[model samples]
Target: MGRAWILCKKMFSLTLVFNALLTIACCVGILAGFYWYYSGWNPFAPYLVNGNLLWFAIAAAAINIFPSALLGRKLHTGRFLFHHYFYGFLVMASAVIYVVLFTSVPLTTIFLVNNTSPEVNVGRFFLLGGLTLLLDDLPDVSKRIESGLNHIKAGANRMRKVIVAAQVVTGAFSLYIFAAVCAAMLTIPEWVTPANLILVFTVLITGVTAFIFVKRKAWNNLIVNGEENSH
Candidate 1:
């Protein structure tokens, strides 16, 4: 009775809306940015439409809605809260400020500061946003944030074989996230150009998407199945 009640309550709650609006945007931005870059090399190149993509992914990831969901989950589960989200915010804030105010070191303009060049400055906000997800992982203290894919794995198996197959496929998306980011991260940030902008955007968005995807998926399971802990 208790389990059923919890599931029913969460199923149609604002949680689902918040999940899509706030958290999924993180992943969608990453996917879209990768799509922009992958109009050739990646598999989905031919399938997705072209977008005059903007650079708001970094800011959205930094905003409280994104981290509040991730860190809020950690806090609820008795994990280290302050270091992860607070530092995450600071990293993103620094990224925004640097990109807006100090992307190029005027004192060292002779080094290389070509906006038209594909090689970005490499060390500014373009690179800094990568640290948010890295810091979010408090692995020494616990598993840190629980995985959403694992929750699907723990779903009811006795009901049907199809459900098990679905679980496997769903959990596999995590690999897609990893592979997509690896493709982006491997691209050396050397100049400031459209492609380079997208690359840095990809790196930062990956961190945000990965963190939120894990947290949002797990919470979704809790809402839909009332199964918080995976067996």
Candidate 2:
């Protein structure tokens, strides 16, 4: 069982790296497409410009770059927590922005005129990719839980306990957001509803709470010394 677990970890890491490469390749392809469009060297230049592929490319690049960077290394506790909170914010913000745009504009008319346009498709693709990446990192989540438990067993400091609690809450909420977004995508119009808005806000609050706890050294002090000590 131990060997199997190790193999699974290895495979998961490889998968993350592979996804990162694919995202980078997509970014490069988008840039190349733009170059061709601007240079008028490609016959599809006009179509590319009309389809708003550039924006899709930019969005794809922006969304995927962090995950790529994150997967490029072995997961560390601090870095992993930071990644989750930061990526959670991005996902939440993007969902909110998308909802606003989707409701305010006549997206149907735009899609009708450019059925093959990459704009809409790209956002969906990126969101799916981000969710997939997060799900793939579940093993790391388990590792974190185990580590936290070990810390408690070792008589962890108050700050450590708080951090662990925050980690669990933040991680669970992040997973919820991932699942919610996936479900939302399957529905018609793919807009964020009030429930979705609530979920995003909750995630934001959880992340901010975790950040505050992480940033403050006051929580690290126990009653033993009556003085704060840096962890």
Candidate 3:
């Protein structure tokens, strides 16, 4: 049993690491897409170049996305629903702030550096990403849950717990990023542009990676219910 538990832990760690890598890859891909799609064609490109405030927001986004992706991936299916929801909400909130600041009316009142912060852009980013994430994951969540029983059948409760815990921690980190962004928006000067967008992407990615690494390191030592008895 001890041997089995150890094996479970090992597998769990590997899955999480792999998932993290995948999330990073996804962010990079998205960044490239953003650049390619908007660089020369978008009317807002010059605004970003001139305002220069977008850098701060980009920095924040880069720092936050990594963990948000992981949290979405790691959230346990059953017992930690609230945690998952919180993280999802946080992600949505951050996305909304960024999108609104960039796309619509002048964000000067808030970030003080944004170009046109149109009211129509209000919460647009959040609405887009939040809905997409929710829609994308809803089906997967159900599939994962339905299949989870097989894991239990194989005496893989330990495995399940690890995955679930990873999810919870990921969610927590999302909340943290959300808080950090809110704080930054309140305190820091606002700027907008492609460069700033890149910065935000980087910041979000870095933030997520840092949180996952920290949380996973701690989670490794944690013993689920069957740790002692089963082992």
Candidate 4:
């Protein structure tokens, strides 16, 4: 038990270090890509629309990065509660940013379509992502906050299930959110396009596949439970 705790401690530190590195890399890479794509435009232009879109994309990217980052830490430390709180923050931040962008960015630009009707504004993306993360992490967090039980593995598994479900649900709902945003900008609202729908499905599949690896890992330790004295 002591050794397991030690390993968990190490895992936590390593995960944090890894996430810090990846976050920096992703942020720099994404910003560079944006700059390259919009090189012709004056980045400082006072237009809130484009600027907001850029911000939204960046914020969303950060939100997406949080799980991997937290997982990296949890994989090393086996401490579930700490990372759960971090994930909750990530979801909350992403939700707020998505809502802001929903209002600021025109839907026509997102879909490259024309519409005569006003966009049907439904800022559900924020709620979806936030609620999913919350649903996934709350139990673990509550357990940790309320008690000091070693529920890391069980919590991890629960999160995996919730996240997998979220991935599946988000695949469908995100399109609606995107379509609504685009329709709001005079583009006719449509069902989620095939391309975006495919992307979401692909993500769901990947997450499901990845869960197997993590699932096994949560129990890969050599120590036998209830037999700590023998060691």
Q: Could you report the Cα RMSD, in angstroms, for every candidate shown?
A: 14.1, 17.6, 13.8, 15.5
- Which tens-of-lDDT digit does each residue in 1-231 have in candidate 2? 765664555455535433433433333343444455345443123322332332332332233322333332233323434444356346645744663475343433321221223455444444544454444343344556535544542464544565455444553443344344445544534445443343344333333433443445323532322211110
Put down candidate 3 lDDT per residue, 137-220, tens digits, no spaces: 432345464255334424533454554454445444433433444444445446344433433444454445445545565334
- Model 1 TM: 0.27
Clashes of each: 6, 0, 39, 10
- The alpha-carbon deviation from the true structure for residue 108 of candidate 3, after best TM-score superposition, in angstroms, is 28
Model 2 clash count equals 0
Question: What's the candidate order when arranged by decreasing lDDT?
Answer: 3, 2, 4, 1
Q: Select the stronger candidate by TM-score from 1 and 2.
A: 1
lDDT of 1 by residue, 105-124 (tens): 44233122324232334433
C-alpha local distance difference test of each model: 0.37, 0.39, 0.40, 0.38
**How big is the positional error of residue 147 in model 3, measured in Å on the Cα after superposition?**
2.5
RMSD (Cα, Å) of model 1: 14.1
Off by over 4 Å in 1: 1-82, 104-231
Give the C-alpha lDDT of model 3.
0.40
Locate the minimum summed-lDDT window of 10 residues in model 3: 222-231
Query: Residue 184, candidate 1: how far off, in angstroms?
Result: 16
Compared with the true structure, model 2 gives a TM-score of 0.24
Q: Which candidate is the best by lDDT?
A: 3
